[model samples]
Target: MLSNRYFTNGIDIYFDNVCGSMLDAVLNMTNHGRIAVCGMVSQQRLSQPEGIYNLFNLVIKSITMKGFLQSGYLHLFPMFLEDVVRFYKQGKIIYLEDVNEGLESSPIAFAGLFSGRNLGKQVICVARE
Candidate 1:
């Protein structure tokens, strides 16, 4: 829903996919908001990931913060795929991905992800049938 729009009031469920803007996210979050930390691509390439501060806002605003990995939802893959396909067909979503074909190009693709060179979902395709 936040593709190219603005929030009138404030954010409700903030998904921290980038992991570099916790301070700003917390600042704009409504009371009792929740944060789901999924990806940390911003700090993936760094030798030392940047530390997050101002966590007291979570207490003051009564926010909940949690981290999760994609594998955690492995059981829901089929249902998720069905929904995604239906949404795509209905034109509710636009899928974008950067695929590097061949195992030899995986290094380049992986590097492109951390460097922001890839435009969308980074994928290293080892084979095609």
Candidate 2:
């Protein structure tokens, strides 16, 4: 549960419900970073949400940011898969995951996810595919 993970390694990819962290992530990103805005969880509750002032960082740093949800893009799944598969084959994309073994580890893995301990997409391997 280290808060400084991004601050230390810098954010190559970022997404947050709140814009404040998004700004921080923008600043913390390495060169050629990407930001994918999935949802704004906290802002949904807040009447006055935060605003990001330093968007120029994206331009200066050559960062890319896009906001979208999977459900909204369900129709484009085939296209997405084709592109992703090609990218993967070309080694243009890197995937990261924190995989935990056993069904018993799920609770801990789930907890780590919320606590920010997981480094990437967290998964509990109840069985092999």
Candidate 3:
């Protein structure tokens, strides 16, 4: 699957999870690039997992690696909300929800979070708050 990515063309940014070959290929590319890390899909057993990207290559290429988390922009929430609402209104940001009916479904919904069974956001239907 990584081979099909064809990162040989060089990309400005790459997002991957624990796919060392993909990261390695991106690093090996002649042009500089950046990678956005969401999760490591390959390292499921390790208590503390690490990415496969080579530090030497990253330094040589002047690539930037960054973590994307909402908390990092807590201070920018107000500005983010303004843009988010505009995007939502324009129908640019579409959300997929897995809604399991019944109060007892909370356990199942929570389990999906860890198992990756939920393709998008997972929600359990209970009494409306």
Top model number, lDDT: 1
Off by over 4 Å in 3: 1-65, 127-129
Give the CA lDDT, 0 to 100, for residue 89 in model 3: 95
Q: How would you encode candidate 3's per-residue C-alpha lDDT over 1-129 as one tens digit per residue?
A: 232354435456666554444456556544467778766544565576545556687788788888786567699999989999999999987555878988898897776665445544678788776
TM-score to native of every candidate shown: 0.55, 0.57, 0.50
For residue 15, give model 1's deviation from the true position in Å.
1.9
Pairs clashing in candidate 2?
none
Clash totals for all models, in order? 0, 0, 0
For candidate 1, lDDT tens digit of each residue in 21-101?
Answer: 433444457789888888877777788877766578788989898999989899999999999999989997754677889
Instruction: Give me the overall lDDT of model 1.
Output: 0.71
lDDT of each: 0.71, 0.68, 0.64
Instruction: Spell out the clash pairs found in candidate 1.
Output: none
How displaced is residue 51 in candidate 2, in Å? 11
Residue 36 shift from truth in candidate 3, angstroms:
4.4
Lowest-lDDT window of 10 residues in candidate 2? 16-25
> Residue by residue across 25-79, what tens digits does model 2's lDDT show?
4554677988887766435555676666667788898988888876998999999
